[model samples]
Target: MNRLTAVTLGVADLEASAGFYSGIFDTPPNRDHDGVCFFPLPGCWISLFPLGHLAEDISPEVPKTRSGFSGVTLAHNVKTKDEVIAVLERARAAGAAIVKEAQDTFWGGFSGYFADPDGYHWEVVWGPMFDFTDDGALLFGKG
Candidate 1:
């Protein structure tokens, strides 16, 4: 049996994408070589590679051009509602498109959405009843 170990994103500029995620996640790349950068997250690896190269690696086919929303969103869960706003603010300053401003949600949490240069969506959220370990793993229902 195999486990999903990493999530790699194809970006136009590897260094810029690396910097963007590094700032938000507060973790520097563990390895950067030959136009690829790897950041080790709690239980997975986040990699940034050139779009053309990533396409070639996955298949001889060129990468697909995305339209509208892809229905995929990366999330950042913070300790406080204020942190959600702060994160969104930071992302905006870093050139992310603010798709949705932070606000109280019907789900009893607070969140907002933003998009990277390539239009990949991200949700920055804070839930009063959710907690995370130091290693970035979530522990829910026990605030």
Candidate 2:
């Protein structure tokens, strides 16, 4: 219960979503089924599935409508401030809408936001207080 192995996004067009993510990652999905795609990331995996099917898979009562903020965001952390801008630009070129231009954060970080085709928010950040292990697991407050 303390670990996250995957984050699944309910998307309108599975192929388009998969292609979007593939362009961002510069790698093809590890698994691409009829209506699902899985990209294996450093610390976890990201999966895209048809929105309607995902809602039904949750419960028959769950609504498939998606709108507005979903109260959750996925983040990509880099070691340098320039990388933050680079990632955001890469995402924009891959078809994401830049929701917020990169700026200095009150938390002493450089960051920005972008929305995927399905309107899922993603933050590209670089914090002075953060680092990563050799295997890419995020390390915070470790000097």
Best by TM-score: 2
Per lDDT, the best of the predicted structures is: 2
Against the reference, the lDDT scores of all candidates come to 0.83, 0.92
- lDDT by residue (tens digit), candidate 2, 21-81: 9988889987647778999888899999999999999999999989999899999999898
Residue pairs in candidate 1 whose N, alpha carbon or C atoms collide under 3 angstroms: none
Stretches > 4 Å off in candidate 2: none
Candidate 1 structure lDDT: 0.83
TM-score of each predicted structure versus truth: 0.85, 0.95
The C-alpha RMSD in Å for every predicted model, in order, reads 2.3, 1.2
